[model samples]
Target chain A: MKLLNKILFGSLSAIFLLSGYDGFSQAPDKGSLSVAINYFNDNNKIPYVLVRVKTKVNGKFKTVPGIPLKLFLNKDSAGLLIGKVVTNESGEATSFIPPSLKKEWSATIKHSFHASFMGNTKYDSTSADLTVGKAKILIDTVGRSVVATVLELKDTSWTPVKGVDVMLAVKRLGADLNINETATFATDSTGKASGDFKRDTIPGDLKGNITLVAKVVDNDQFGNLSIEKTVHWGSKFVSKANDFNERTLFATRAKAPVWLLFIALGIIIAVWTVLILLVQNILRIKKLGQEA
Target chain B: MKNSKSIASDEQIIQDLLPRKFKTSGRIWVSLLIAICLVGIYAYYRQLRYGLAVTNMRDYVSWGIYISNFVFFVAISLVGSLITAVFRLAGVKWGAPLTRIAEMIAVAAIIFASIIIIVDMGSPERFYNLFIYGRIQSPIIWDVIVITTYFFISILLLYYPLLPDIKILLRFKEKSGPGLHKFYSFLGSFWTGSHKQYLLSKKAIYALCVAIIPVAFTIHTVTSWLFATTYRPGWDSTNFGAYFIAGAFLVGAGSVVVAMYIFRTWYHLEKYITPDHFDKMGRVLVLLCLLYLYFNVNEFLTPFFKMKESEAGYLNDMFSGSFAPVFWFAIFTGILLPIIILLFKQGRKPLPMFIVGIMVVVGAWFKRYLIVTPTLLHPFMPMHDVPEMYHHYFPSWEEWAITSGSLAGAMLIITLLCRIFPIVPIQETINEHHETAK
Candidate 1:
């Protein structure tokens, strides 16, 4: 019983000491906050990059949790605010950059990102710069195998990037398989990364369109990139043109049902026949009236 | 009154009701018609040179006033079947004097109906393609079949009834000049008033009367299907067939009333088409108006009650939105006011009925416009990715010109038919008088 009381009292004292330490740490005016950005690649492209804010206290780096950070992209002439995110319990924040931003991608392949911490009275405002390099992905099929080439898009030229890691991924709809068909390879001197995929190992959607993704996620220069291609792998037709018939009732080119067509024709024929008979009857009127 | 009493003699009946030459007013009216037709032809020339882009129609409101005018013509044409076929089958003797007038309206309206539909086509040159590539499944193909059928039947109905009258007119060899006599002989030289000829004509008419009822029902029902087959909110209803047919009968009867009054006043047909005829016809119009009102309620009320998600915007626009004025005007003037005024015996007088008939016709015209345009505006998908003008539709000047020209053409046909033939059947009136005197 005494050991149990000692353990409980020790936990309460530890909580009090932690609260006291937080109070003393927040009163300092000489601390500096810096943001570190990291990206994760699932299929060659980074869906989002993570931003971590750390404070310099007593010449050491400690993560500053629950801080609001503003992310901005610096174009040549101006900086545009992308989004704002609050740091989580892990002192990390994330923002998604859309593929449309790649239109502004220059020959340098380098993007300057700034993360700023503001709107807090206790901490001095701080900002940090993050430089990221991105590479474009190209995929081509050779027989039963696939080759993924990672290239840097410069002004008026395509520069092949070498020694970069590339991954090949295949996506299927309604698939529950945990099987990994992702093949990893390094680009050769020609900046072409080659990988082989078995036809049986690949899956596809109901229409037999297999989406193949080529990815380059972890590169010191190019941060993250991916390109997806939908190919007719197993379907008999190359496009959806053969999926529906133009002679059907509910298709884009709607046609009358067979029964309806027959009925309409029957009505038309019967009416015309009766009308012709009526005309013949009218012509006979003069002769008939003379006899009556 | 004295002339009708003196029509005891067949020769006197001939003199009383033979075709008369036009007066100054008639000449002026014919000139006006020619002028309007010429203007319309010039406007159509411009349209052909350019494209449908000359009209305010866009991807959204593809059909405009041209379709509405076509519907109006078709609707008004149904009167021939109603007055001649329906009344004759029912053995109503009072309609005998009115048959020729109704038939004239029917023939003219139908001719213009065909012309207006051709005008509505973006490429009238491709009209030949309709027959070449026509799928029996298309409502348009069905329309082509039925309208052609209706046109032929209506022509025969107008012709067969006029055979005896033409023979009577041929008796006046010197009264009608060589030109008119030649035309009359060409039309009815074979129409001998023999007992066999009379019997055969009667049988033929009886057969037509019976046959036309169903065909009449089919033409309007099929016309309604052209709209009901679509998924538009205002047009998507089973009641559309009955609604269109009921409205068609109303407008057709109204036009017949207007024609009856004009002929009665101008040709001194008062002796034949008396106030009693006007009273009965006024009553018929009132009943038709009421029946049409019932169908209108069924078409709109249930939908208004539920206000289905798709129909809500269209219904609201009709009830209180941008289209409310036209909607209310069509309902009140086209239907309700006619019903209210036609209910009274004094209002059944010739002049009042004539005014009511004019109101009904004009209002029904705008009603057809509402039926076509508002529903198109409220398509199932949201209106997007179109120019601002596409979101709303108003007929361009070319459309107005063409529409007015078609109307003038129809009037010209009616006027010319009147000039060529007696407005009232002389032999039938004499036959009726002989039977009554017996």
Candidate 2:
């Protein structure tokens, strides 16, 4: 019995300790952080650089959320800070170029950007730089055809950039629709690409105006740059207004389907009516039993 | 002389079944169940404090053992409708002795069904929102409505029949402890045993019996709709409602058999809950098991035959993958083995029937687990982006404790209820004897 008790106590202690081993384990070793930044100028209206932070874990790149990223105009230093943002759930942060950096941004013909992340105890600090020579695509329309001319800013001059690919598409909320069957239009020596708009009539706003966008995406020389031109070349589209009063399954509680309300109310009435009658019967039985 | 003998037998039968005091073994059994319930309560407190994060459920397997446990409770509770409403309506005369037992199990199961569902809801505080913002078109709302209706009807059915028994207990008031005497009076003091009162009580019970059948079917069907309405590959089926109903009746009947055997053995009411009762219940269990097997074929065989690309993975997982053991075990033990055993005359004996009853119940539980988990794991879209742990599921200790607690809690209710009332109806057994003697 003594031997049995000792063995049993030993086993129980080992089990309890092993089950809570995680609570006693050492702190986790940190992984090296990978930071990358890209610049997007959509008609220069919404100019922002998105910096993404990721770390390889178990052979897959997982997003490192809550990392603070700082953007610089041309140097990885504090004085030229465009903006600062903490990474969100997707491990990416958007920092819009502030007015304070506009002077420095315009001073350099070759536009460059830098992003840096200060490390914590879990991760090593890292920085990444990207330089996309300032470029823009100009959209023009000639009878039944749309055209885009790509230009790069050199020293004091905007020269036509050759052999660069330009994609002309109809801009929408989601992905852009191709203008034609052509996959991509590579700019010729003249730095011009054009597509015909006679294939299909796309629906636009109530006024039938569509924004045609010409973009140079992931260009080796000029990064993501897009310019758009609005034209009254689309069929008028009227959005179907939401009717909260509509009665359907998917509708709100107040707008439950009429058949459903009727059936549900009917069943509830029927079942509860039986239940109520039973209650009355019980009461009558009590009254009769009292008389007895 | 015959009159004197009838009176003596009636006295003897009544004396045989008055709620007796617990022996040491009984106290120990009740204590063990109470311990389990306490552990479950503690686990629930932990769950409320830590949130669902304490559970092993994740993106891929969101509905785990909790949902399955809920289904098991709801399914097992269906036996009351089967033994009480169905048998009474069919005029199965022998069902009279077992009516209260079935009703007791049903009432406890349904009450815990409501509770276990709330336990599954992480935001049980918002339960009233189910009513205030409830949509009639949603099957969940329908389930709530029907379960509530079934609950009241079941309570009435249990109560109406027990009125006579309560009057008998009132006669022997001194035999009952002080608290129980007051409870008996509070519950049924108004039942004065008048001819008119008897007629009225019978009519009320009859009405409830008639009312409960469709509500029982609706409750189970609506529960199945909670799954069937989803377009997930395993859940998308028109046959789910009937299938769930069939399975409910089988598991419920199985539980009743187990309860019947236990009650007969413990209470020593061998004259009332006889071997003949076991044989009859075994036949009922056999029919239910066969019916469930038919529905199983309908639920799975067609899906397997078509081998639709969407269903292929789920079917393969059930047939040969990680879930294969549980799947085949449920089929063999819950359905096939019960039928095979109960089909034989010798196998319908109490001991064998009890073992088969346990097998059916245990298998049915794992079957619910299979119904819930494998489908969730085999979604139409591939499982990705989630941590590797999410791809597989095994309930954490907290989940097992709470689920086991809900089960033990149900049994505890049945136990306390048994302590309060005679396991076999004293008055009804005497009435049956009087009618036969006449």
Candidate 3:
């Protein structure tokens, strides 16, 4: 009886331990973090961001490589100059900061590879503090060549301003600027204008800033200005166009392997059919023996 | 010169084999069975009026006593194959007198097995859905097909052998009432008792005996698969089919032993159902019990060995927890105790064997309950978000009424069968007697 008790106790403990181990192993891990993001864009504003990490690595503050380095802004903030772009090889990024006097301002650099390593820096820089002349404007267009399409400027009310003439211009770095050449267009019935301004026909050199001026004929409504906005263009802007083309090509190349998958499924079915026949034959013989 | 003594002619055998009208006690038994059946029918009416809600079964115990009772009936029905087909195929001459009794029990139990399963269904009204929407992969469909085949084969097996007896009953129209006499004649009027008819009947019986073996196996195997196919810890095992079949044969043979004892005692059938018959049946029951015990150990031990995460809770429940007492009782009474008791020669006497048979039948009923309900209670998800009543099950009055009705109904069939036909095969008994005399 004592020996039997010892054996029973030994078996019981072993079973408990094994069962506990299995339960622990199958429990789902819950430590990993997951995130979701939403982006907004409009006619005046595009959802673009550049994220760079300035971190202390190997005892030196260095910028991280291969960060997606993009920026995003809410759709309501489209009228404000928002979003940013990364620097090309020189470790500098360009951004169009909207001239808002509000101090609820922050900048985030989002990285694709190190998606978890998101960083944000808040600044109290207001439009009054940062003088208009000292703030440099950078324009990064995603198209290979600039097309001077209609730039229909509307207020928050969305009403078109008649007889509001607008001057549009472009400049590129390391090129001659033709300041004498400009496209003058007016808003249509639906607040839209379209015309082409050639890169060579631009004033000064192609390397500098392109300034657009909307000179209002009458200041009937709000005390806003016939504002002049200058945009600096560079070579870094051209890669975004190439990125779009590459994605399209990659999607078209993925259909051939899908057909091979169906052929493999047919082969599997054939093998299963043969196995079923063999098992049925064996069962039939056993059944006959039982009857006999 | 060699045939100096006169032998009992075939007419004497036929006259002895003819079914007789019921006596006072037989009439009383039939009336009692009918009364119980009426009460059961009223109970079923209440259940139909109120839905299954009239039962104590809740969502957690969705299947209560009805399913276990169904399993019990199916298990008991398996004896038909054991006595009629298995014994005949093995040329066991001693089993000849018991064959019709066993076959009658099989037919009665299988008939109620079908009825009780329908009673357990939530929508007996939509029973046609079982055929229309039947999934071939489901064990229920397999059970339906095999059980139907087994029932018909069992009926044919019962009928073909009775042709000679039925002709004898038809000739003695004075012993039977006008109504019953007409019924008997209608059933067997085609049987001329010619040599060709006898030969044909014998061939058909042989064919049915052959056909019923697999159908019998398939019925119980598919019934086992109903539980085995599920992924529950207690149920998910390849051994279930054999384990179930073993237990089924045990309980079925045990019931037969009890029936043999009762019929022999009540009808003064000692001349036909002898003590030797009881002794042989006791041995058969003991063998079946031991086989079932071995399978039970295999079914339980390996799981107790590993006790994987999924099986641990279910094993704990059965082993030393809430379900422990019932589990051990079933093990001891259904297999171990019967085996131990039937091992002794004196214990194999009719009275003690009858007691053991009752124990086995009751224990096997609880064993089937353990098979179905406990595993359902221990599904992968924790039992939550249901009413408190759903967590446990006890048969409501309506459920008891219906279940009791089914049992009484089974007894009623056997009682009616015995009233119409000789409970013991007179011709087979006389054949044995003549052989002994020679």
Candidate 4:
């Protein structure tokens, strides 16, 4: 009994001390965040990087949005600032390589990107870094066959990147469709891979323009790289003319189907005319009753 | 005077037919109805405060009890047109006394029908947008037009006949309170019942009788179109318009029978609304039930026979699936048993007719529920990958209260109309008495 009293007294004292800062309440301790950064170079030709901030919530990892991230080039503390961004719904923030860093960009055969999320009351601070060698992919249509070439920068000179895997695909709305049966091909000693222009009957824009892409997935050196080219191999899509003044079922009130409007209007006019006549008769009844 | 050999019989008819203040039971009935209406009003308050989220409606079952209640009210209101316009135009003399009753029911039911439709809308404030930006091609707008026309016509129909009755009511200022006296006078002070006035009033009545028939069919048919235009399994049928009309006529006739029995007993109007009225209305109810049954067979049997892939799930659900019990209950009680019972002359008696009438009404309400929700549940695209709660639906307490309130409010309108005006046409009774003496 004496030992139990001591233990209870000690627990109560701990609670009182813990909550005594603000009259039985204390500020909550923030959870630490995990940060991951990925590099992307699209048809934009300008390289960009995205950062994702996440934290453990209810014993499950949940992406934390609205965290401000600073993406910098090369050095961690005194690097050139590429851009500032805030995380979106998926806890992702993307910032493009700024034009102000063009001189610094051309000076390097390889580059380093650093992303930092400053500490907030709801989350502790976190940072992530990625280093990638400069690389580019080339895609061209050559006599019914498609060819892609991979090249990397080595000491200020373009060198063939051999044995790198390339994916040939047709860009679509949600995801790209593979161009050939064996879509992925490895570059030979010459840094070039070729596939037959096989996919057809793909629907495209009014001018029959479909986008073709040759891409390399995440590589230890190049990160992610892709190039897109527009081709006229897809089926043509002729858009219907949308005239605002057209009269149809779904058109505006004045543009309603003529026959329907006539039928409806005829009925309304006929019915309301008869109704008005009846109401007039009621007024005549009142007049006659007054005279009586 | 005026073709009557005796004045005492006329006075007695007037005394029996004049609106009487409610007795204790009547007051209690009205109070109970008022309580229900108040509860419904409070439910509506909650619905408005918290939004439609308070109801059990979700994406799967967007149209819930409110819509079904609206359909039921619209169906029941069709009775007024049948009893007042169709029968009156057919020159059915026995129908004259019941015209006022049916018209009252019609007016009451339609008022609530419009109100319930507004209650179904998420943004009742934007109701004007429907008018301003309404597409004529839309069946919903067609419904609004027809129903509004029907409302005005019903009001006129109820008013045109009540002029002479109002004049009679004006004679008894002592019986009707000062408030009611001024109200009736305001309604019919100029109604001296001259021949020229009668001629014009008759012309207007005849025109309305003709006008209301087509308008009535169009009203319910357009309502049916609201569902038929949709591509749902049960609703995507060509037979919906006629099927709806048949059911509407059945429920309307059933309600009239119920109202007739109550009025006959409560007012002690045995001499006026006799057993013959019940017997004839019973026969009418049986015919309507049979017609509706025929449509029901046509609606269900073909789909059941072919068992098209799209319709198979809904048909099975109606036949012996999760909804089988409610399905069979609506069928047997609403259509089949009413036919079997009303087939017998004993079932045409006032009390038996009233019981069957209640059955038909209650069963019809559930049948409307089945029509709306079950087809929605068994959508062409099944409700998978959704919360289990979305897979099923039952009315929340708020839905029940608001629906009950709308119904009770409708009845309260009828009750107040009965309290203020004569249920049976006093002039018709006077004319009948004079003819009998002659």
Task: Give the best candidate by DockQ.
Answer: 2
Model 4 per-residue lDDT tens digits across residues B1-438: 222334467788899899999999999999999999999989999999999999999988999999899999999999989999999899877777789989999999999999999999967998998999899999999999999999999999999999989999999999998999999988888999887777788888899999999999999999999999999999999999999999998998888888888988999877778777888899989999989999999999988999999889888988999999999999999989999999999999999999999999988998999989988887888866888888788999999999999989999999999999999999877977777677
Model 4 residue B241 CA deviation (Å) reads: 1.5
- Model 1 interface DockQ: 0.22
lDDT of 3 by residue, B85-203 (tens): 99998899888878988999999999999999898886689889888876444568668877776786787678667756775677777877788789886666666655555555556
Judging by lDDT against the true structure, name the best candidate: 4
Per-model TM values vs. the true structure: 0.72, 0.79, 0.61, 0.79
Q: Write the per-residue lDDT of candidate 2 for residues B1-438, one digit (tens) a residue.
A: 122224458878888888887899999999999999999999999999999899999888889999898889889888889889999999897877788888889999999989988988877998999999988878989988888888888889988888999989988778898889999999899997888988888888788888899999999999999999988878999999999999999999899889989988998866777778889999999998989998899888999999999889999999999999999999999999999999999999999999999999999999999999999988888765778888789999999999999899999989888989987777777877877777
Q: Which candidate model has the greater TM-score, 2 or 3?
A: 2
CA shift of B291, model 4, Å: 0.9
lDDT string, candidate 1, B1-438, tens digits: 223564557776777688888889999999999999999999899999998889888888888999999999989999999999999989888888999999899999989999999999978999998888876767787788888888888888888888989988888878888999999988888887877777778787887778777888888888989999988889989998889999999999999999999989888877788888889999999999999999989989899999899889999999999999999999999999999999999999999999999999999999999999999998999766778888899999999999999999999999999999988888888888887667
lDDT by residue (A20-89, candidate 1, tens digit) is 6764555655456777876543445544678988877778888888898787776322246666789987
C-alpha local distance difference test of each model: 0.82, 0.87, 0.66, 0.89
Error of 2 at B69 (Å): 1.4
For model 2, how does the per-residue alpha-carbon lDDT over A1-292 read when each residue is reduced to its tens digit? 9999999999999999899879778888877999988888788575678898999999999998999878888887789988888999999999888887778777877767888878888898888998877777789999868899988778878888788888888888998887888867888777798888853578988999888989888876677889999988888997878776689888888889888899889989988998998899988988887787
Spell out the clash pairs found in candidate 4: none
Report the first chain's TM-score for all candidates. 0.51, 0.71, 0.21, 0.73
